[model samples]
Target: MGEPQNPGRERGLDIILASRAYDLGFMSDWGGAGNIISTLYSAKSTNFASTWAKIETKARTELANELALFRGLE
Candidate 1:
C-alpha cells in the first residue's frame, strides 16, 4: 500500500496565498473578496505553485524583518 499523504498542506497554501494576495491589494478598489478570488483564479497556471511559493517566502521574510525592526524600537 502507498503511504498516506498530508491533505492540509494544499489547503493551507491556498489560504496563505489568498490572504497574502488580499493583504497586498491584488484587487480593484470597487472589488472585494470575489475580486480577489477571481484574480487568483486568473493567475492560475502550471508555474503558479512555484510562483506562489516564492511569494510566500518573500512575505515571510518581509514580515520577519518588520518584526525585528519593531522590536528594536522598544
Candidate 2:
C-alpha cells in the first residue's frame, strides 16, 4: 500500500500568504501613525503612499505566482 498523502501540506502556502497579508496590513497602519507624528512635530512627511503602493503591487504579483504554483500542483 502507498503512504497516505497529507492534505494539510497544501495549506502551507495559505498560511504564508495570510501571514504576509497581516504584516502588510500592520505596516500600513504603522505608516499612518508615523505620518501623523511627523505632521504634529512639523517634520517632513515622506510619501508613504507611493511606497506602499509599490509594495502592494509586488505582493499581488507574488500572490498570483503562488496561486499558479498551487494550482499546478493539483
Candidate 3:
C-alpha cells in the first residue's frame, strides 16, 4: 500500500465535531459550557463527536445543495 497514513490526521472527528457542536454546542454555541456549570459537574456535559456528525449531515445535505446552486451561477 501507499505510505502509512498518519495517525494524527483526523477526518471523522470533524463530522463528529459538527454533530456534537450542535449536540454539545461547541465553545461558541449555547455559551461555551462556561455559562452552565454548577458547584458540581456530574459529567463532562459535552459530546463533540455526536455534535460533529449532526452538523456534518446537515451541511452535507442543505449547505451543500445551496453552495452547488450558488456556484453554478458563477
Using TM-score, give the best candidate's number: 1
**How many angstroms is residue 58 displaced in model 1 relative to the true structure, after the best TM-score fit?**
0.7
Return the TM-score for candidate 3, rounded to 2 decimals. 0.32
Ranking by lDDT: 2, 1, 3
Alpha-carbon deviation at 66 in model 2, angstroms: 0.5
Model 1: per-residue lDDT, tens digit, 1-74? 88689799889999988886344333322223224345567777556445555456555566676668779999
TM-score of 1: 0.35
Q: Give the whole-model CA lDDT for all candidates, comma-separated.
A: 0.56, 0.57, 0.49
Those runs of model 3 whose alpha carbons end farther than 4 Å from true positions after fitting are 1-44
5-43: candidate 3 lDDT, tens digit per residue: 876557776677777634422333332232234311445
Give the TM-score of each candidate.
0.35, 0.32, 0.32
- Candidate 2: regions farther than 4 A off: 1-51
lDDT of 2 by residue, 1-74 (tens): 98789888679878977776444333443434323445535645476665556455555666576568779999
CA lDDT of 10 in candidate 3? 73
